[model samples]
Target chain A: MPILIKDRSMVTPREAIAEGDFSIGSNVYRREKKVVSQVIGLVTIKDNFVSVVPLKGKYLPRVGDLVIGKVTDVSLSTWIVDIASPYPGVMRTSTSLARRFDPIKDKTRKIFDVGEVIVAKVFSFDRTRDPMLTVRSDNRGGGNSPYLGKLVGGRVIDVSPSKIPRLIGRRGSMISTIKHYTNCKMIVGQNGRVWFKGNNFEDELLVLRAIQKIDREAHTTGLTDRIKNFLEEAKKNMPTPSKEKQSDKEKRSEKKS
Target chain B: MAKNKEETVLITKDGIRHDGRKREDLREISFDVGVLDRADGSCLIQWGRNKILAAVYGPRELHPKHMQMPGQAYIRCEYRMATFSVPDRKSPAPKRREKEISKLLGEALNPALFTYLYPRSVIDVFIEVLQADGGTRCAAITAASLALADAGIPMRDLVTGVAAGNLSDKIVLDLDDVEDKEGLGDLPIAYLPNLEKVVLLQSDGIFTPDQYKEALDMLVPACKKIYQLQRKAITDKYSQINEAVQKDIEAEEKDKPAKDKKKAEDSKAKDDKKAKKADDGKKSKASDKEEKKKKGLKKSSKKKDDKKQASKEKEAKKD
Candidate 1:
């Protein structure tokens, strides 16, 4: 039951991680008694479980995941939402909208048009069919809160889906840090699209830069502190806006958080 | 054919080939992985004079929907040779040979991948031959596997390839352009070293029963040797990144002392791992040295067997 490589070491595909009756985790496959990595990633062995976290890959749709999707095409009943995954997300008018609107009198596009960014939940997904998306606010964790809805006035930037965890950090520490420092209202989608709006364009730009930095250095450890320091340094150099405008914006962001 | 072999002098009386290599020697092989920034993964392989670039894209949406596999992702591979790659300008158009090789390479790589994970998707591997030499197909497969691995595609094993040829009645390890054109037989094989399976096998020209067996023996070892090089190339890329990260951490530790308390415990654990790694490395090296000596003895014994076979053949011919 000896582990072949060091824990958290970068391992290539087919490289043996451990041997024995170990419970296998994602990105690793079992061959007889030997557990082998199935992707290029950092192999982690915890207790008796062995898993490899892949450095790069497309997002796989998982149930109950918060995803930011762009409406690619609007139909009579369903809007085809591209969730940055292989299979498109199908958002139904019946399930997505709050009000029951007649499709014959008013066009379905009147509610949610094409190319609109929406933060939705993946209610159902399997390999056989496209993932289903729900935009109803009740679909979110907290009751009746507007966590899932069409995003507005925020720049949506895409990062590697695999790096989304790093950007969000351990227990939301990283995202909250960025939000606290830059005063930016941020929505991080598990599928890699990040929607963020700040008091000023400069602050929004700072958030974008920090995210890009995280995406680039996600493989490195101790990234949370580095990002925190970076935001502090970058925020110091920016010119302060009018006190009234700043305070008002700060209050809104505070309320949202 | 016998007269032509005598006239060309591919292998001299001293048993050295025209390029001054012994019968058991392979050409210089090197790999540069992740060369294409836009591609999901890419690799440039230089094997002797042969240069090939391989790029991988997807596990993404499969187009033309009908072609999408219901159970597993489709492996679409295209092997193309650049027009100016050869001495005479090869046609830029896809030829029958190119199409066949593409299909074969794709199939060869399919067994090495875990395609069932991504249903209704396609993993496209594009291999371009920039320089023409013998064993281009073998080099292409080798580079393509590296590219697939670099793309972070889940693979069961990396495919390695090498060609063994029968040159002027003597079997050779790796054949070059001149030898390939004039050789008695050429056998190119793509092998999964860890799995010990032949994913692709192609034979051209002619081979006796003994010659065929001997070629397999030579090719398996050659492919194994190439596999080691491929593994090192992939690891080297990651290790470089690891070094950069390590340096950054050291620099940050010097700047911030308050965080040292937490990092100190982590560092102590890391130091223990490092010490254990050093001990493991030394033990492995000693064992590796012993294995090398054993292999040397086996090779020498095989040479004696080859001599015996040659003598027995001579006597049979005389009879």
Candidate 2:
């Protein structure tokens, strides 16, 4: 018979848990009649399934994940990109470039030189091979994906990949708020790399602070509202561009009159 | 040298050792989990005077493709003692003893891990002994296991290590530097406390069959005790994180109500201003009645504020 343990907050390794528990996640295994926790974590039961939510872990790559990668090596047809994972991400010249080119005649290095940062999607990956990345979607009808291709003149900051969801928030709410407040365009990668591009250095710094705050406090609830309030406070303290523009308009009108 | 020889009486007649610990008494052990931010998992262990730091990286792509295993992940372990770790300054080079301990620790840890989950990958366990007071290998194994767990590596069970030695013809548990140097036999054992199995057992010096059996008997229970401390350390770190999450949730909930109250108060104040203007002809009479009502409202609001403050204090105390 399987014993049902309910409302237990934490579990240590080798602790006998219930069988038929559906939510069992990493560091948990099923035995003859019992499930065992393999690492120390909080046990959460949802919809009658038990899963252990780990407090810390390394990033494991998955297909269809958007990642920020730095070009490490440029070969004849492929570029070896470091996606901050154990396995290097490979981008073929055929899939990454918008225009077709012959690898025999054209130098792949000209298209993507070493040390260039590119935001791409994980097209395919398997345990046996390195992850293949694509700069744009294969669907021709989708046109150019705005976020795809090489990132230029922006600072890339890293946070724990697990906290990326919190930074993005539900339906991109947190990220949108940061963009609106700082007037900065931001790209968040699933591999914990974030690209920040703003009008000035100060705005980029503000966005960086917000991203770091979210990473540090990702486990907490109401993070979206907290980030919203933080951005609002930061905006209030900054000198307003609108005020300067208004003064300029008044001075022009006075001169015209 | 004469003083050292005179003090070589490691055990008293009642079976107490030089450190004043009775037979079967382990050292004071403590664990600090996730000590390094960059590593996947890391831990610092303080076992008596021995301080060991263990860091784990990977389940990552293994280099030198030839060494990659198709069916299971490779567990690589490196054990190093700092030059200043021992009383005498040791050389920085990897010596024979370090290599042997590293290989054995890797082998001992592999059985507990679910390596099949990450094929063609490697998990590296790096152990650095900052201070050595004997039983460094056992302490390193203990810290490495915690670091692995901290890294969120799946395992069948946690490994705990302890040493039992024959001092002055008596089997004593957790031999210190002095006892180790003076003892006749030292048995270091790494065990799966929950599984009731030994993964690594090494004996230095000589022991009779009965003496070896007695040492085994002492070592297992001591390992189990250390296992409890390891579990406590991991849980304590996570529980503290859980509390912070809960507090943030509570604060967010509190903020919503306070904002709503502020909006309600603003609208009510506007309504009072309109009422006072409309009743301008009977101003004196209306003002007295309004003052009394305002006092009553203030008293009630004060009471509500007190209740909210009390609840917050209770929550803080609980945390």
Candidate 3:
């Protein structure tokens, strides 16, 4: 069996990648024993297994994914959340709350109001049904950790979901670098929402710019080093903020978007 | 039947047509893919004097829950011609011809796509003909398929379309406006080049059994030729982006080595120029059309009218 395409090369839709007994991966289909690409993407071959990483696409939700979602409507039983996916997510009050929740006795809006953002784990998802979300952290139980529950007092920015892996870098190297340099406490969701709060507004803005740069250059090689140098340059040139203005600057930046 | 056979000569004895093209020649065809900023995928195709802009959106949610398909996504196509696209201004309303073409095009593109992957969603294709000469439906189908592929929708094969005309008992490829109006017969077909499947076929006027077979033979190879152009258009866009990224990386490396005052300033200027070139490489050619639209809609239509009038005068001189 011969591999038709070179590894790490770009391919358009329906272009043949390999023939014969190769294990298929995402964005590829088996046609007459030949593996063909299903989208315009970069093809990767590792150990006889081939996959195509799409350059652009909407996020498709998977189970166990950490996601940031905005509450759109709160009913008596469930809160409808927009998770930046093709399908909406449903967060039930019975599982989301720390204490036992009474649907008839308590109002759903009291627990999680409309337009509030929450960091949640996708508990269940199938193509036929909407994804089910749980705010309860898996290890410690209640939503007390920074990774779960209502996200408050942080700036949330969006990147393309397909570029999330590049943003995170190799084993969190890219994200850790950004966090260490900017001194920002950041949480990145699988759905491409980044929430971070730094000591000053300038650090937050620097993180925002860095993320945008990464998104733009995601397909390029040596991106991690480029971003590290970019962050360093900005840190050296930034004017120091006055201590008193930090608090007000946070409020102003929050209102800008 | 050539009703005005005595008044016009579509093909000369030397095998040249009215436009000075050989019997097998096609009009110039080019594609600019990913030209729209907001669309998920878009393409602007210039086939001869016909200009069509196609934009694709979704595989996203289909509204009105009852209308959602159980096993596959629905293909929704809308074909609209601009009011000033033709010599006579078209009314700003959907006509029966537009609706029929829309339905046929949606079906023409269905088998090529893997619609079942996104069940219950809808893929919407919108084609706007800014200028129409002839064979617009064929051109619309050709561009719509490219737009779908650009949108990253899974496809088994790409579709290509072209029309074959019967002029003075000779089958010719790619009929223009005048030949389409006065020619004896016109046969347009959309084919999946690699798969060898004819997704759409329409016949108008008269064709003997032998002439019909000859037309099909000419049309298939013509579509294959056009398909090569479509593939090149797509690959060229990606290669341009790759080159831009490579240049940016090289420029960044060059900036790191200079420390002297004059040398640093010189490197900075060079870096700026490199970045500008990178931007120009990635920029779509649609910027000119965008500028024309910004100049005022009425003004651009008037400009198109002048160009059409000049061509019309040239055609009269040939007659």
Candidate 4:
């Protein structure tokens, strides 16, 4: 008898499973009484529903996902941004800024030049057309506001989008830990772009190390704890807080004079 | 073909071929998965003297918006042979044979995929034949399916292919380049072993009706055998990854306890050192006045007691 595998379990294509016994998930099909998996992945069975978590795949854009995008084309009213996905995202001037401007009167080219990177949110996406992005805040609080526009003076790194969930962790625990330890402001895009801005080059490097570690071991279990421990050990060797404070005071005095 | 037969006997009276194999024997085949990092999925297949590499990308947005399928994703395949693949250097340009093979392979693979799950998307499969002995198209299809699976593309079942040929008036399986060039007829079949469906069937040259029926009988079993190998190849690759992940988790678990213990010890030591410094400070202040010297002595003795307790705990742990 062919083995009958359940949902959330790992399976390869053509593996015979009992139909209706497993929830029909992506890359799996039910033919009569048998369910066959389409992809090589971990089977996900939840509440009588079965799906496979593909080990490798391309990113599909969804609404409300924050993304780091590079401006590719500047038009009169719209700018095309490459969100590192197969589909390019389009940002209209009306949705990109808080203040209204006439496309004919205002030079849209001056606002967002090609080759610049910006943090934006996917406002709408349909299968029929390219995804639409917005820099304008949803009238929400900090971080989600319109002010979260063009990113300046930071390096962008790419990772597989599937690993983004692990980087974010449960309730943003993994990301917050990195932020606290490295003191780097990070913007993680669903499209697999990560922007890192730290107080010093050393801190930024630490953040990059943490990100690379996460990317390498995203499939493994207990990664969050490992990352936390790694950060803690790194924190121990960091420059003393007093020295940082002294530098801050000197900079402030220089500005005042 | 007749002229070549006089030069060499392809089959013996007892039914053994020149390669010293029975009529139904297949080439020695092996599969390697995830050979390319950038591709979504990739596989390398070695079938006898044939070497083929396949790479899969997308199920992402399809280009040429007009080509987008409203209900399902489009599966595109390109089959190419390197210039050095054949005995005579094959031209670098795409040939008619390559185009026809590419179309047939794509059609054969389409039945295996769940294209409806990804609307308006395209899954591209590129097959490159690095060495061609014979049956390059079959080998390419087999490798392409593995690459598709490696890429995590959904499929009903993997497509396994093999070619049956007529040589010395006998049906032979897995014809090599020499046999193919001299064979009277060739029938290549790609099958979905689990589905029991023939997705691709093509024949060149002539075959009697009975000979054709016998060939199908031989081809089915041959395809089934190849399917088993295909399944094994994918499973082996994933199992390797699983083992590596298991080892990583185990190492992390083992390292975590040691780290926690060291952290606890460091914190305790810091506390003890802080207490010692406080005692020293009291001693110096007490030296200023003779009356306060006795109180300072009591504090110093208490500090010693704390250190003794810490050492005792350490001894207990060691024991």
Strongest candidate by TM-score: 3
Which stretches of model 1 miss by more than 4 angstroms?
Answer: A139-146, A239-257, B1-7, B253-319
Report the TM-score of chain B alone for all candidates: 0.78, 0.82, 0.80, 0.81
A1-257 per-residue lDDT for model 1 (tens digits): 89898998998888999989899999999887899999888988899999998887878999989999999999898899999887889988888777786878867787778989999999888988889999876634655543888888879998888889998999889999999999899999999899999878888999999998898788887799899888875764454444446689999999999
Give the alpha-carbon lDDT of every model. 0.88, 0.84, 0.86, 0.84
lDDT of 3 by residue, B6-30 (tens): 6678999888999999999999999
Docking quality (DockQ) for each candidate = 0.27, 0.31, 0.24, 0.34
lDDT of 4 by residue, B1-319 (tens): 6776678878898989889989999989999999998898999999999999999998766779899898788998999999999889998999999999999999999998878767888899999999999999999999999998888777888999999999968999999987887879999999999889999999997799999999999999999999999988988987887788678768877987997887686666555555676564443322333223334556547777988999999999999
Model with the higher DockQ, candidate 2 or 3? 2
Stretches of candidate 4 above 4 Å error? A1-3, A6-8, A16-18, A21-27, A140-148, A237-257, B1-5, B60-71, B257-319
- How big is the positional error of residue B196 in model 3, measured in Å on the Cα after superposition? 1.6
lDDT of 2 by residue, A78-170 (tens): 999989886789999877777787967899888779999989999898777788998866666777554787899989998877678878889
Please report the candidate that would top lDDT against the real structure. Answer: 1
lDDT of 1 by residue, B88-107 (tens): 99989999999999999999
- TM-score per prediction, in order, is 0.83, 0.81, 0.84, 0.82
Off by over 4 Å in 3: A140-146, A199-201, A243-257, B1-6, B259-319
Give candidate 3's root-mean-square deviation (CA, Å).
17.8
Kindly list the per-residue Cα lDDT of model 3 for residues A1-257, writing each as its tens digit.
99999998998877899999999899999988889998888899998899998877767899999998899998879999988876788999877777788767888888779998889999998878889999877665665554688888889988878789999899899999999899998888899898888988999999999998898788888899999988986874564554236767888999996
